[model samples]
Target: MAVLTGVSHAAEPLALCFAPPHAVAPDVRSQWQQELRLILHHSGYELKLAACTPESIELRVLRSNPRQPQALGAARTSQSRIEPVVEIYLDPLAELIGTRLAGPLGRAMARVTAHELRHVVGQQAHHQGGDFPEGYSAGLLLAAKPAHFRIR
Candidate 1:
């Protein structure tokens, strides 16, 4: 299913929006959203992000599970098709980034978010290669900086 060249690898601009995270700082949210946008753009998408409508494919930022602070998050899917709702935890994201290299926490969060999103966009399963890797590591999250993530 290789697209080859001069072909699009993404769905035509879908209604992909994000739910504003409660109790999260505005600046952090802004940086996260901006970085997420840039990553998706670089990864070849033209999604129309906005406040969630019932029909929109929404990425909701939620509070982290206190017991699993290091856990990134998950995307809900039905059958083989990804569902409209994708949830990620901000507190855990910050915890994963940790105090080391705290500067890029927001940017790093974008990568983590994009990781989950690719699962939806590419209709991919874990470890199917590309952005849907088997798992994440601190080194990858903190040190690695790919120009753009691959979808497949």
Candidate 2:
């Protein structure tokens, strides 16, 4: 699963919408949605609580069988070219449920998603280098816990 890390400019209003598969548990889904909102709020991005359209950023959490748990979050420039569409995916059970390390995993997802959005906004490239001034560091997002969720 990919997490959203940070945005290029916080002042620009951005929308975050979840596109989950129907198989997800209600409780778990709610938790994930709440966590996403909290991450956006604390990170200083605007959360548009509407359904995803061509103009909005879409974040998804799905189950997959990979060697290691991972996330795939990316941002794409929209058709209008005014805002970027950020997409986040995560290993459903691994990152969203309450396991021993779930807190860190969720935080990581948020950070990675943010990173992808930055990429979409032309703040940073997929790869990092001295030339990329807006590189994302996962450590920053994990530094704080979500406002509504606790690790313990």
Candidate 3:
């Protein structure tokens, strides 16, 4: 597992904790991390692997259930009196093998991760609609390579 902190000076502090899939290759995980950082960076946030800090938003990465229906990823807030945590399931993405999305798994995973992070930072689950919003899809952010990502 790895812990990452966002840009400190930002108005809201954020941290990302990643629990890599046991069966996944190390190189693939590295690629995902790289892409995740780059994608998040474009959103004007910095990420560093470390322990959770005071008042920092917490997010986690875990493997999803394979026995269930197809789900590329899922994220939700874990309500707690102390600190709430956001979790993103990755087993579904990890299970995609020899398929059309296999080639872009890393980028796809990054997109999913970015989507979840937006939820934590925005503190809401609203999508702008019209196909793909800021957190809903990476086609615009990752493909178009915008100067910065706006949390809408």
Candidate 4:
């Protein structure tokens, strides 16, 4: 759960939060949380984990005319709204739970979550292209290997 600010020069404030894992299998939940935390730590943002009312997250993206390449192009813009509560569902019951694939998948979700938070904070316009830094990718997160026990 990380929240970034100033994604783009003209984007609205954004917030990225992580919903508690609701995996039926304890091990799976633990793994998922761990991977999420790793990516969040590297995202260079703040984390806020609290209870909310609504059960779903709200994300909005608006496309504007492209700006000049060289000159400080116009700032990008964005808007986001997160419900009070987080929606939770059973984790996928796949045999790859504790394998290399599981780690990468969890890392990918974490990256996406962090990427979204950057939008909320106003770092980038939306979750596309190389707008974000290089390390946001799952391969990088895995290669770096975060030290924390669980994804916060």
Backbone clash count for every predicted candidate, in the order shown: 0, 21, 2, 22
Task: Write one digit per residue (lDDT tens) for candidate 4, span 81-128.
Answer: 422222221122121122335545454334434444444444444334
The TM-score that candidate 2 achieves is 0.49
lDDT accuracy of residue 26 in candidate 1: 63
Candidate 1 TM-score to native? 0.74
Residue-by-residue lDDT tens digits, candidate 3, 1-152: 87767645553224665443334456655766677677666666666655566545455555663554455444454563223455545565544432224335555566666665666666655655542353333344335442333333
- Give candidate 2's root-mean-square deviation (CA, Å): 9.3
lDDT of 4 at 115: 46
Report RMSD (Å) for each prediction in the order shown.
Answer: 4.2, 9.3, 8.1, 12.7
Model 1 lDDT, residue 28, Cα: 69
Ranking by TM-score: 1, 3, 2, 4
Mind giving the per-residue lDDT tens digits that candidate 1 earns over 1-152? 87668866664565677676545566766766677766666767655767778877777777775666666767777886777677777676766667524347667776777787777766765656444576677677766654445333
- Those runs of model 3 whose alpha carbons end farther than 4 Å from true positions after fitting are 1-13, 19-24, 53-59, 65-68, 78-84, 94-103, 130-152
TM-scores, one per candidate: 0.74, 0.49, 0.60, 0.37
Q: What is the lDDT of candidate 3?
A: 0.53
Give the C-alpha lDDT of model 4. Answer: 0.36
Off by over 4 Å in 1: 1-14, 66-69, 100-103, 129-131, 146-148
Best TM-score among the predictions, by candidate number? 1
lDDT ranking, high to low: 1, 3, 2, 4
How displaced is residue 49 in candidate 2, in Å?
Answer: 2.2
